[model samples]
Every structure is written in C-alpha cells, then in structure tokens.
Target: MADRLLDAMARSASRLYGGEAVSELEHALQCAELARAAGADEELQLACLLHDVGRYAVDPSLVFDTGEPSRAGPHARGHHEVGAELLAPWVPERVAWCVRAHADAKRYLCATEPDYFARLSAASRHTLRLQGGVMTAVEVARLAVHPWLPDALALRRWDDGAKVVGKATRPLSAWAPLIRRCFDR
Candidate 1:
C-alpha cells in the first residue's frame, strides 16, 4: 500500500482537482521536484508539493487544474482563496496565506509594500482600484501575521517558478524515486 501521506495527497487531488488538465498528482510532484532541484529546504519542498492540497476543500470541478495564465478579462474562478480556507487546518496559517496570496500576487502589492507598486499588471491595477475586497487589508495582515511568513514567501516564489508549459513539464511518477531518496535521508 502507498504510505498514508501519499494516499492522502492522492485523495485530495482526486477530490478537488478532477477533470482539469492540471492533474493534481502531476502538479504536486513537479513542484516538489522543482523545489528540490532548486535547493530549497525539505519543508519548502514539501510546501511546494502540497501547497494546493487545500483545494480539496473547494470545488472538485477541475477549474484550478490548468496552467493557463490569468489574462485581462472577466474574472474567472480561482482556487487559491477557497484552497486557503481548506488548508488553514492542516498547516501553518502563513502557508495557507501563501496559497491565497499567490492567487493574485499583484493584490498583495497594492495592499502592502511600495517596492512592487509600479510593476503591477494593468488588470491587477484595475482590480486594486475596484474597491474593498479583491485582497483586503485583513488578508494582508494575516499574511504578515505569522513567523513563517518569510518561509511562505519562499514557498510561493518556488510555486510560481514551477509552472512551466507544455511537455517540458515533468511528471509526478518521475519524482517518486526522488521523494524516496529524500525520505530515506
């Protein structure tokens, strides 16, 4: 039998990430390997792999399952918000915050610092102006609310870096040996 952790990961994916081309298993596995190859620490590698596991609490519809870039237009559905809600129970609040904050890395820029202020996408800039809740001050407060905030930032960066396109994207099964190697260490 697969280990319980692996099993839980699989069930979470099946429950929340079905039908979308973004296979849950594959996405997590790729994130893990990306973190690992990039020399991230073990916890971060795990975070990379499981960050979206919270999606299990959201729709089982497969919408968050694609790598399509969010373009300027009608707001489509997103998993990070609901996924953040799902993950709050299982990991550090900062981890969940990372997932939520990642959905619109731009929103955080508007809510918080001035450094990234100018780089904002035109759509995200519009989102910021529209008012009151694309990403609220409360969420920003929570994002800064954890000691792991730095770690969460790192994990989010790692997550973004993992989203390569097409066949160049690696497979989950390909990482089983790597996971085993890490686990055995």
Candidate 2:
C-alpha cells in the first residue's frame, strides 16, 4: 500500500494546478517539510503530505479540464473528502480529519485572520472563490469548535507556503518510512 501510494504521487508529480507555482509532489513534500520543522507529530506531518492526494486520485481530466463548470468546485469529489477516504484505511483518524478539513481551514483562516486572504497565492485565491469564499461569521463560530481545526489550519498554512518554486526538499522516497510508520495496518 505504501509503495502504491508513493507511486501514485510520483506519477502525478508533473501535473500542475492551473495557478500553482509548484508541481503536486513539490507542494506535498514542502508541506511535509514545514510540518516536520514545526515539530508536528508524525500523523500531522503525514496529513500535510497527503492532504491534496485527491487531486491525483481522481480523474485528472475532471480536474484539469476547465470546460465543465461542474468540475470546478474546489470541494467537489476531487478534493479533500476523496483524499481523506482514500487514506482512512491506512492512516490515523487525526490525519484523515486534517485532510478532510484543510480546505475549510483555509476558509476559516480567511474569515478570521486579517490579511490572510491577501496572502493567498493567485491560484489559491481563484480556488477560494470556488471553495465558498470567506466563511461567514456563523460559519467561523461553528468551525472554531472542531477538535481538528488547529491541525487543519496548520496544514493549510503549510499548504499555502509549499508553493515556492524551485524550493528543494527531501525526495519523495525519503518519506516512505514516515508514511509506513503512520499506516494503520
């Protein structure tokens, strides 16, 4: 399973989102590096690494082809929910929850933090509009109580920063041990 997951990531590494500066693998590795630097537990770091896996898991044609409006929803089947479901069989509940909520975490931060929206990359900003935009006051208050919100928000921050072009990090193979360690078995 671990090898399969790594292979999928490698296969999708060259596929870039419309506005993201980094390829999918680079973003994932960078996010994992950020989580490790912050001393996050293995599960959180793994969550950061795989939060966007759904983009690879789903039909690439659905994600990359912009002709259909139905395919453009950021939280559609192409986003967090599919990734979380894919990881749930192997990963911790915390990791799955973080992946599931990372998109919402972005909305939460944009609503609650000043200048947070402005800090988003152009691609992210474009997707944010598709992702229900900023959270309303009520939505913000609702998400504040989620147990996984902090981890999700942290992952979101890492996700945002992981777009650095040409940033170097450990190879994808270097993460296999951590990925194996976190597998639920």
**Alpha-carbon local distance difference test for all models:** 0.53, 0.81
- Candidate 1 ranges with C-alpha deviation above 4 Å: 1-4, 8-21, 56-146, 166-185
Q: How many steric overlaps does candidate 1 have?
A: 0
For all candidates, what are the clash counts? 0, 0
For model 2, the local distance difference test gives 0.81
Colliding pairs, model 2:
none
lDDT of 2 at 14: 82
User: Relative to the unseen true structure, what is the C-alpha lDDT of residue 138 in candidate 2, on a scale of 0 to 100?
Assistant: 97
Q: TM-scores of the models, in the given order?
A: 0.49, 0.88
RMSD of 2: 2.9
Tens digit of per-residue lDDT, candidate 2, span 1-185:
77778888897688774567678889899999999999998889999999988787565444422223555555445367778888998888999999988878988999998999989877777767766789999999998998878899999999888988999999998998887676625
Give candidate 2 misplaced runs (Cα > 4 Å): 61-78, 182-184
lDDT value for model 1: 0.53
lDDT of 1 by residue, 97-178 (tens): 6666554554554556665547543433443443233458787876566666666666645554444333254555554554
